[model samples]
Target: MVVGGSLGGLAAAHELRAAGADVAVHERSAPRTPAHGAGIVVRPDIEALLHRLGVPVEAVAVELYESRRLDVDGRAVREEAPQWMTAWDVLHRVLREPLADVCHRLDGALRRVRVEGHEVTAEFSDGYTAHGNFLVGADGIGSATRRLLDPSFRPAYAGYVGWRGLEPESRLPGDLRELLSGRLTHFTSDGMQMLCSLVPGPGGELEKGARRVNWVWYVNVAERDLPALLPGRSARRSASFLPPGDVPPETAERVVREAEASLPPALAELVRLSDPFAQPVLDVPPWRMVADHAALIGDAAGTVRPHTSVAASKAFGDAAGLATALLGWTPAQPLPAVALEHWEVLRLDRLVTLAGTGRELAAASGLGVGAGRTFFTGD
Candidate 1:
């Protein structure tokens, strides 16, 4: 049984079914793509999963040739190696389409997980219950299963938020039209940093004029100011993210002004014209990933900063590793803790390294400078 029906849970179910095991996924929220999302830098691990699942590389993916660091005037300081990047929406659709025929329980929240002897039973908010040999938690960073297992686990703030934007190629000013196409560009100065790259347009359009240029800017947000930066109906949801128009106009304008004052001309223009969105950069620790017959995977396992470009890859790795461990283990068989323990040991190391690298880079004085590549290079 799998809890959460996002990419992580879907991938887990996919891998398990491929390994000849019956799987069922339960999701708390509606099974639909979120309106607010960001871009992801795809790595080989995710590519391998796609190939393994026979999911073709559709036009939804955009190739990046070089990452160019620019000066205040948009002049190149240096160029670094490139990689492929895609939108969260595109990958979600690709992963979900194949599972259309899979056993999915949408809009069902897991209220309780009861372990009796060797069997684990999951009770949902919809009055439905499921019995399985093992449970996989793919419910994201705020996973209920993770909370039930380890109450002390909480995401540590990185002292800043990753301010992101998705602007269309067509809407761009004529002067900056060729600035970010076919390349990942960035600007860094004083303590401010920003990066830009092309991602597939809406519905994964690959055409030059139809694509979207994605950018992210990191800025300090003191703990006291977080409540103001994040505006919800109630202050309790400050930890949650806020989309463009929902953010306070004053705060949004201040962010745009900061971008204009700190970033290069091209990036500043992109930010000025973008629909702003903000997500706090967080660090997650190595929690008890496996408790008896239950396992925590995906963001539920670790929420690393996005600098490493391993967010989705880690999810794929978790799914692949868990599937391999349960290769022929059936739901009717006795659940073994040895394989789950081994899987957690292997997963924690990678998660710790990725989180460490992201925090270090984020704290570096010259984060976007030096053409330095320290994380997830397959190195």
Candidate 2:
């Protein structure tokens, strides 16, 4: 059974099914629709995985043939490195379509997990329970599985927040549109890093006029000011991030003003015209990703800062590792403790290194203290 049916859980479900395991995905909420989830840098391993699932890659993705770095004055240099970009909404659809045969239980929020000698059971809030040999927690950063496993573990808010926007290509001024088209562009200043790229449009259309420019700006926010900066939907304080339309209008206006004052002219206009949202950068350190018959993947296991841009790829890596470890396992048998241990060791090692790298990058970028490299590397 997989808890949380977002991209991570869905990826886990797909890979495990490919490895010949019967899988079921339980989601705490209803199915998601596109909320301009923004762009994702496609990794080769992820592309290969999609190919293995027979999902046509190009139809849902846009190829970026170059990368550009712009200064505050809009002066820039370009490199011929090529990478594919896709909207988060597009990727989610493709990953979800292949899992039609798998059981998907919606609104099935997990309440507790029970483990016996060989069997594991998940109890949901609605008084429903499901038994299985193994369970995977691909839930996300606010993972109930992680909390249930280790109540002491809490996701630490990094000293900054990422403000993201998706501006329609047609809505952009001709000059600004031309400047951002067909490339990944980056800009950085003290305590801030910003980037933009062309991604498929709302309906996953990759045509010239149908595309959208996706941008993200990371700026330092004082810890004490977070409550007012991000007013949550409920009385509870905001957790990791806020979705589109959740950020207050005044905060969005303030971001636009900051962008105009600090960012390049074209980039500032992009922010001014687009609807911007914010997510507090967070680091979720994992004490242990594996516990008996259950394992945490994706943000559930650990979350590095977005400066690394490895969140999606990291989730896919976890899914790949878990599927490979359970290659011959079935629900009829007990969970393979030895194999799970091996997988956990490797995943843990990588996550620790990745988290350290994030801190180093954050420091170098002025989001934290100390000196380090600000290079972006893949998972």
Candidate 3:
């Protein structure tokens, strides 16, 4: 059984099935792509896993021929940093389409897990129970499975937040679009970094006029101001993230004011023309990733800062590793404890290394270690 049917959970189920395990994925919400999403730069690990799953990345992705650093006036110094980019929705669709009817049980929100000897069971809030020989927790950062294993788990907010948005290509000002096309652009200033690149539009439309420009601006924000920035109707719901349209009007206005003051002209215009959202950058160097018959994968195991560009790759690698460990274990068989233990030992070390790399990158950029004014408690 797999808990939390996001990218990690879904990938785990797919890989495990290929390894000859009968898997059931339990997701709390309806299976749908997030409306407020960001761009993804395809990395090697994820590219390999997608190919293994027979997905043609080129068909769903856009290519950026160069990486350019821009001045506040929109002047550029270009380099040959070629990359393939895709929208989060497009990739999610590709991964999800193949599992249309295989093993998804939507609305099955996991509430508890019970382990009796070699058997593992998942209990859902909806009063449902599922039994399996082994359980994988691919649930995201706020994983209930991880919490069950270690109640002290908390994601330390890296004193900043990313303001992200998507602006339609057709709507961009003529000169701005001409300058940004076919390039990934970035600008850096005191306590802030912003980047913009072209990505496939809604429905994976990559044509010239149908694409979208995705941008992310990272700014240092004091912890005390979080409640004001994240004013959701329900405090708990918007503590960590505010999806697209949910960003409060005043917060959005403040973002525009800040953008005009800090960003390059073209980049600020992109922010002005888009409906922006905010998500606190967070990290947690996981102390433990496995316990008996259950193991956490993806963000559940370790929350790494996105500066490493390995967020998705690490999750996919975890899925591949877990599946490989269960390669010879067939359906209705006893749990492969020894194989799991070996995988856990290796996985723990790798998770630590990855988390450390993220921290190093964040610190060099002046944003990772003790970056925030206060630790986020999700109050």
Clashing pairs in 2: none
- Arranged by lDDT with the best first, the candidates are 2, 3, 1
- What is each predicted model's overall lDDT from 0 to 1? 0.76, 0.81, 0.79
How would you encode candidate 2's per-residue C-alpha lDDT over 23-110 as one tens digit per residue? 9999887656335465777786577688888876788888988989999999999999787889888788788888888898887788
Give the per-residue lDDT digits (tens) of candidate 3, residues 1-379.
Answer: 9887777787787888888878788887765536547788888767877898887778788999998999888788999988899887887778878877677787767788888877888888888889887888887777778878888988777788888988789998888788779988888775677888889988899899899988888777777777777775344455457778777676788789888987888888889998898888877667566677888898888877777667777888889888998889754667677877788788778888888887776666566435532222243
TM-score of 3: 0.92
Q: Mind giving the per-residue lDDT tens digits that candidate 1 earns over 1-379?
A: 9998877788888888888877888888776636446778777777877887676555558888887888887778556576788988788777788888877888887888999876889988899999987899998867888877887877777666678888888999766768787788877664556788888887889888888888888666655667666774333354646665566667668777777767777787788898787877666676767787888998898877777778878988899898888786765676656786798899998899887887676667333223322211111
By lDDT, the better pick of 1 and 3 is 3
The lowest-lDDT stretch of 10 consecutive residues in candidate 3 is 370-379
What TM-score does each of the candidates earn? 0.90, 0.93, 0.92
Instruction: Report the lDDT of model 1 for residue 113.
Output: 90
